[model samples]
Target: MRTLIPTLLFFVLASHCHGQVERDKALHFLGGNLFGLAGAGIAKQASDGNRIWTFVGSVAGSTLIGLAKETVDAGQRENGWDNDDLAATVLGGVTIGVTIDLFSKKDDKRRLRGRYSKLDLKKKKQFLQPTSEFVVLEGKLPSLNTLGLSNQQFVVE
Candidate 1:
């Protein structure tokens, strides 16, 4: 009975809102990208630069924040829930998250000193020409291995 009243009220309030979902706003795009960048950065720092966790947390956090914004918007008569804004937020979050991960991986060799060495241009050309790709050998750090990426081959095109 207690739960039912709030649920009923929620529906009643929700039913009052009606608006065409707004998209293509500059503010939405900028806010989404910023949110995404912050989300990924925070997650990466908190997780100590673990790739998977950073990506997952970034996307999840951005999406949740977007939804929370929409929930508040839903009650506002001037602006209802905007699916398009949420989509933009999620996209921005994913784009920045993946980009950060890629950049981190590219720079990982420097961080994992002595495990992998620099490849000469000639040798690099040889490897590049044959397969049109080169693999990044992730070092066997105990923590990284726990993430299942240790010694994994990440192809660079």
Candidate 2:
């Protein structure tokens, strides 16, 4: 019974939060992008209004979800119940949830890093492109952040 309670708790949480990957991804993206946008939004608000509270909310939600899943996983391990699919499914769901949320928000301004980066595109250019038009490439990471990006634009018009 030592492990059973935690297992059940995890199950309940997961069941209630099933198919959350989009939401999780959305939240992840939203939280990451907030730093850029908050400067314009919260700058004029009262002292109590800042980006910190939204950030805290995102952290608590994501952490609680991970902790619940991990706790059940640990309990299951004690019984030798190896279920990789369940673990993977939960993670996938959370990721999808975050992704959905991230893209759902409207942002007039988005940061485009490294002009030569293939993924970087003008907002209008991206809108006209179909989803399947992307060209994936394998690349090695540069050794250091100090390196300057090539001036030629790699992204297709």
List lDDT for all candidates, in order. 0.64, 0.41
Q: How many residue pairs clash (N, CA or C atoms closer than 3 angstroms) in each of the candidate models, in the order given?
A: 0, 22
Candidate 1: the clashing residue pairs are none
lDDT of residue 74 for candidate 1? 98
lDDT of 1 by residue, 1-157 (tens): 9999999998887666423324454455556667776666666555555667767776877787788878998999998998887787777778767776666553453321121124322232533445554435585434545557764565456
lDDT of 2 by residue, 1-157 (tens): 9999999999999887767645544443444344323322222122122334333433444444444545675778464333343344334434433443354343343321112123322234524655654333466544333246553544457
Give the poorly placed runs of model 1, Cα more than 4 Å off: 1-25, 105-157
Q: Pick the candidate with the highest TM-score.
A: 1
Off by over 4 Å in 2: 1-49, 78-157
> TM-score for each prediction?
0.49, 0.22
- Top candidate by lDDT: 1
